[model samples]
Target: MKDILSVKARLGLGFGSLFLLVLIISAISIFSLSDANNRFFRYVDGIGKRKELSSELLLAAQQRAVSARNLVLINSSTVRVDEKNIVNNAHRKVGELLRELTASVEAMSPGEERVEAQRLISDIQQIESLYGPVALNIVDLALNGDKDAAVVKINNDCEPLLRKLVEVVTKFIALEEQTSAANVMHSQDEYELQRNQLIAFCLVAAIIALALTLVITRGLDRALGTEPSILSGIAQRIASGDIRAIDEIKTARPGSVLASFGQMQASLSALISEVHNSSNVISGSAQELSAATEQTRMGVSQQRLEIDQVATAIHEMAATVMEVAHNSESAANAAATADQQAQTGGVTAKQAVAQIEHLATEVSNTSQAMLRLKQESEHIEGVLNVIKSVADQTNLLALNAAIEAARAGEAGRGFAVVADEVRNLARHTQGATQEIETLIASLRNISEDAVERMEVCRGLTDKAVLQISDTDVSVTAITTMISNIQEMVRQIATAGEEQSAVAEEISRSVTRVRDISDQSAASSEHTAASSMSLAKLGGTLKQQLERFQI
Candidate 1:
C-alpha cells in the first residue's frame, strides 16, 4: 500500500473499498433475484400449466359427454347439427388440452415430479381416447336419423365411457394439483436458501469493508501526523485566506508531515511581500492606463459618431440611386413601347402611301376615259347635222316632184299621191334630226365639264400620293430615332443599376466599418474597466497578504 498523503485520497480509497463491497453485495442480490425469478417462471410454465391443462381436459371431457347426449335427444335437424358441432368441438378441445398437458409435463425438469406428471398425462390421454370415439359414434348415429339407435348407444357405450373418463380426468387433475403444490413449496425453499446466502455474503462484505476502513483511517492518521479535526481547521483557515495560520502550523508541527507546508508558507510570505510592493506600482500604472483608455474611448466615440453619419449618408445615397434605377427602368420600358408603336405607325404610313398612289393612278385613268367620252359626243353631233342636211334635200325633191305631177292631170294624180307621201316622210325625218342634235350638244358639254373635273382630281391625287410618300419617309426616320432612344434608355437603365449596386456595396462597407468602430469603442471602455478592476484586485491582494508574518 502506497502512503496516501492527501486526506481526500485516503478517504476516497476507504469509501471506494466500501463501494466495491456494496457492488459485490448487489451482484449477489441480483443473482439471487434472477434465480428466484427463474424458479417462479418454472412454476408458471411447468406445474402451473399442468394444473391448468388438466382442468381444461376434465372440463372438455364432461362437455363432450353432454354434447353427445344433446345429439341423441334433440330431434330437429338444425338442433341436431348444433349438438353435433358442439360434440366435435369439445372432442377437438380435449385433444388439444391433452397435447398441452403433455408438453407441460415434458418441459418440467426430470425428477419424481416429472414422472408423476407423465403418468397423469398418460391417464388423461387414455381417457380421451376411450371417450372421444364413443361420443363421436353416438353423434354419428343421431345425425343419420337413427334417434332410437343413438339413445341405445349413448346408454350402452357413451355413459360408461364418460364415467370412466370422469374418474381418470379427476385423478389426473388431483395429481397436477398435488404436483403444483409441491413445486410451490420447492420454490419457497429455493428463495429462502438464496436469501440466507445473500444475508451471509452481505455480513462478510460488511466485515471486510469495516476492516478496510479501519486500516485506511489508521494509515491516514499516520501520514497526516495530526488529528483530522486539526487538519480540517488548518485547511479551513487556509481556504479563508488566513495566512497567519501558517505560522501557528509551522510552530506546532516543525518536523511533522506539515514540513512541506512550512516551505510553502515561506514561499507564500515572499510572494506576498513582492505582491505588496507590486500593488503600489500597479496602482500608479493602472491610473495612468485608465486615463489613457478613457481618452481613447472618447476619441473612438467621436469617430463612431462621424462614421455613423457618413454611413447614414451613404445609405441615403444608395436609396436615391435605387430610386433612380427604378425610374430609369420605367423610362426604358416606356421608350421601348414608344419605339414599337412608332415602327407600327411607320409601316401603316407606307401602306397608306401605296394606297394613295394606286388611287392617283385610278383617278388619271378616269380623266382619260372622260376625255374620250367628250370626243365621241362631238362626233355624234356632226352625224346629226349631216342627217338634217339629207332630210332638207329629200323635202325639196318631194316638193318638185309634186309640181311635175300637177302638170300631168290624172296621170299626175297617181304620181302626185306618191310625191305627197315622200314629202311627209322627209319632214318627219328633219324634226327627229333636230331633236337628236340638241340632245347631243347638251351631252357634249357635260362630257367636257366632267373631263376637266377629272383632270383636277387626278392632279390632286398625285399631290396626295407624293405627300403620303414624304410622310412615310418621316415616320420611318422617327421610328429609327425612337429605336435609338430606346437603346440609349436601356443603356442608361443598365448604368443606373450598376451604380446602384456599387452604392449598395459602398453602403455595406460603411456599415461594417461603423460596426468595427463601435466594437473598438466598446472594447476601449471594457479595457478601462478591466484596468480599474485589476488595480482594486492588487490592493485586495496586498491586504490579504498583510495578515501573514514574514
Candidate 2:
C-alpha cells in the first residue's frame, strides 16, 4: 500500500470503493421495493378477489331461495309463470357464481387455504343442487293448485338448506379475509428483513470507505514529507534574503523539492563573492590614476606662469627696438641733407680757390674767406661730436636688450638673434662716427694750413684749394655710412616685432594647456570619489551576502 505513492492511484482507489458502496445500496433498495410491490399485488389479486366472488355467490343463493318461495305462493297463471322464470334465472346465476368461486380457489389458494375454499365451494354447490329440484317441485305443486303444500315443503327443507349455504359462504368470506390479513403480515415481515439487511450493508460500506480514505491519506503524507506550513515558512525566509535557513531545512524524505533550492543558493553565493572582489580591484586602480593626474596638472600650471613672463619681456623689447628704429630714420634723413650741403660747400670752395688764383690783386678778399672757412670747420667738428654721442647711446640700448633676451631662455631665442643683429649695427655706427671725427680734424687742419699759406704767399692758394676738395670727399663717405647704419636698425625693429608675436602665441598655447590640465585634475578627482563609493558599496554588498550560509 505504501508502495502506491502515485497520487492518481490513491485517488482512484478511494473513489472506486465509494462507487462500489453506492452500487450495493442501490441494488438492495431495488430488491426491497420489488418484493414489497409483489406482496401488495398478491393481496389484491388472490385473497381480495376470492373474497369478492364468495360475497356474490351468497347473494345469488339468497335471491334463488326467495324466488322459489314466491313460486310456491302464487295462484294466478300469469303471476306463477313470472315467479318460476325468476327462480330459474336466480338458479343459473347461483351456479355460475359457484363455478367462478371454485376456479378462484384452485388458481389462487394453496395448502389449507385452498382446501377450505374448495370445501366451502362444494357446500354451496350442494345447496344449489338441492334448491333447484325443490324449486321445480314447488312450481309443479302450485300449477296443480296445491299451494299450501308447496309452501310447507319449502319452509321445512329448502329454508334450512339455504340458511346452511349462506353460513358456508359467510365462513368462506371470513377465511379469505383472514388469509388476506396473513399475507399482509407476511409481507411486512419480509420488508423488515430487507430493511435490516440494507442497513447492515450500508454500515459495512461506510466502514470500508472510511478505511480506504485513511490508507490513501497516509500514503500521500509519506510521499510529500513535509506539511504545507513548513514549506511556506522556508519560502518566506528565502524571499527575505535569509539564505541561512537552507541549512535548517531538514527533509523527512530523500529526493525532496528543497534540494533544488539549496543548489540555487550555492550558485548565487559564488557569483556575489566574485563581484565583490572585482569591485575592490577596480577601486584601487582608479585611485592610482587620479593621483597621477593631479601631479601632471601642477607641473603644467608652473610652465604657464613662466611663459607669461617671457611674453611680457618680449613685448617690452619690441617697443624699445621700435623707438630706436624711428631715431635711426631721422638720423638717416639728417645725414642725406648734410651730404647735399657738403657737395654745395665743395663747389663753393673750388670757386673761391679759383678766384684766389686768378686775382692776386684781391689779397684782402682771400684773407677774409680763409677766416670764414676756419670758422665753418669748427662748426662741422661740433656736429660730428653730437653724432658720436648718439651712436654711444644706441650701443648701450642694444646691449641692454641682448642681456634681457638672454635671460628669457628658450622662449626668447628668436628675440636674442634679433638683438645680436642690432648690437652689430650699433658697433658699426660707433666706428663710423669715430672715422667722421678723424676726417673733421684733418679737414680743420687743412683749412688752417691753407689760411696760413694764403697769408704767407699768394702763389700757395691753388694747393690749399686742392686739399679742401679731398676733405669734402671724405665727409660725403661718412654720411653714406650713417645711412646704412640707420637701415640696419629698422630691420632689427621688424625682427623684434615678429619675435614678440611668436612669444604671445606661445603664451596662449601655454594658457590653454593649463586650462586642460585643470579640467583633467577635476575629472580625476571625481573619478577617485566614484571609485571610493564603489568600494564602499562592494563592502556593503559582501556583508549583506554573508548572512547566507549556503
Candidate 3:
C-alpha cells in the first residue's frame, strides 16, 4: 500500500496532538490549583482551631485564679479550718494551668504570647504566702454560713490580679487569629490567578486546532484531485504527435507532485513526435535516390556520343597525309629520266660544229682563184691591139719618103736631099715590126700563170661544203630526244592520282571505328555518376534511421 501521509495530513495530525496536550496540561494545572485551595483552607482551619483552644484554656485559668484569691481572704480573718490544705489545693490548680499555657504557646501558629501567661502565674505565686492562712479561714466561713462577708472579702483582695490574668489570655488569642487570617488571604490570591490562566489557555488551544483543521482539509482535497489532471486533453494531444503541448505544460504553475507528472507526460509526447519526423525524412531520401539514379544513366549515354565525334576527326587527318606522300614519289622518278637524255644530246651537237668550220675554209680559197683569171685576160687583149697599129704605121712612112726624093732631082740644087729621105724611110719600117713582136710574147706568159692559180682555189671550196651539211643533221636529232622525255613524266603523274583516291576510302572506315570506341567510354562515365548518387542516398537514409532508440 502507498503511504498516503501527504504534507497537509501530517500538519493536521500535529495540530490535533498539540490541542490535546495543551488541554491535558490545563486540566493538570486546574487539579493542582484545587488541591492548593484545599490545603490553604485546611491550614486556616487548623490555625482557627488552635486559637479557639487557647481562648478556652485562658478563660478556665482566670476562673480558677479568682476562686483561689477568695479562699485566701476568708482564711486571713480566722484560722479555724485546715489553712495549709486549702492553700495547697489552690497552688496545685494554678501551677498546672501555667504549664498548659507554656505548651499551647509553643504549639500554636506564631504563638509567642504564652510569656504573658507565665508572668500572670508568677504574680499569683507572690500573693500565696500572704494569703494562704486567709484562704483557709475563707473556706471555714463558707462552710459555717456567713456568705456575705466571704463574698465581700474575695472581690476586694483578687480584683486587680484577675484583670492581669484576662489581659495575658487575650494576647494569645489575638496572635493566633492574626496568623490564620494572613494564610487565608495568600492562598485565595494564588487560586484566583491559576483559574484565570486555565480559562485563557483553553480558549487559545481550541482556536488553533480549528484553524489548522480547516487549512489541512482544503489542501488535501486539492492534492487528491491532481492524478486525473496529469492525463488531461492536452496530454492526449501530445501523445498523438503534437509538438506544441510542451509549451502549454511549461506555462502551467503546478503546485503538487501531480503537476510534475503532467510535465513528464509532455516530454514523452515530444519524444514520440521527433521519432515520426525522422521516419518521414528517411522516406523522402529513398525517393530522391531513385530519381537521381535515372538522371545519371541518361548523362552517361550523351557523353559517349561526344567522345566518338572527337576520335573520328583525328583518323581522317592521318589518311590525307599518306595520299600526298605517294604523289611526290612518282613525280621525282619521271624528272630524273628526262634530265639524263638532255645531257647526251648536248655532246653530239658539239662534234657536228667542228666539221662545219673545216668546210667553210675550202669555199673561201675557190673564190680567190676566179678573181685572178679575169685580171690576166684583160692584160693580153690590150697588148695585141698595140702590135697591129705599129705594123701599119711603118709601111705608110716608107712610101711617103720615096715620093719626096724623086721630086727634088729635076731641080739641080737639091739632088742631095732626095737621097737622104730614102735611107730614113727604110730604118723606121724595121723598128716598128720589132716593137709589136715583143708586146705579144709578154701577154701570153701572164694568161697561162692566172689559169694555174684558179685550179688550186676550186679544190679548197669543195671540202668546206661537206663539213657544214654534217653539223646541221646532228642539231635536229638532239631536239627530238628532249621532247620524248617530257611526255613520259606527264603519264606517270596521272597514275599517282588513282592511288590517292584508294587511300581516302580506307580513312573513312577508320573514322567510323573511332566513333564507336568513344561512345563506349561515355557510357562508362554515366554508370559511375549513377553509382555515386546511390551512395549519397544510402548515407542520408542511415542518418535518418539513427533517431529511434529501439
Maximum-lDDT candidate:
1
Summarize candidate 3's per-residue lDDT along 1-550 as a digit string, tens digits.
3336777567768776876778687778869787887878777666565566556545554544445445544544334244435445655555565555455445544434345434544554454333444444455556566766666656664445455556655665666566667677778787787778777777777787777778776665455434446547545654454434344335444555445656666576566556555545445445545654565567556656655654565455455445545544544554454454445445444444444454444444444544554554465455445445544554554455455555655663454443454445445545645654654555455445445545444544444344344444544554554455455445545545544564565466556656655655554564555455555445455554444232
Better of 2 and 3 by lDDT: 2
The alpha-carbon deviation from the true structure for residue 197 of candidate 1, after best TM-score superposition, in angstroms, is 2.4
Candidate 3 off by > 4 Å: 1-12, 66-158, 226-550
1 against 2, candidate with superior TM-score: 1
Please rank every candidate by TM-score, starting with the best: 1, 2, 3
Clashing pairs in 1: none
Off by over 4 Å in 2: 75-82, 136-146, 229-249, 255-550
Q: Provide the lDDT at 540 for model 3.
A: 55
Cα lDDT tens digits, model 2, 323-365, are 7577667767767776776776677677667655655645655
Instruction: Kindly provide the TM-score of model 2 when superposed on the true structure, using C-alpha atoms.
Output: 0.43
Instruction: Assess each prediction's global lDDT (C-alpha) against the native.
Output: 0.72, 0.71, 0.54
Least well predicted 10-residue stretch by lDDT in candidate 3: 243-252
TM-score, per-candidate, Cα-based: 0.48, 0.43, 0.30
**What is the Å distance of residue 210 in model 1 from its true position?**
2.5
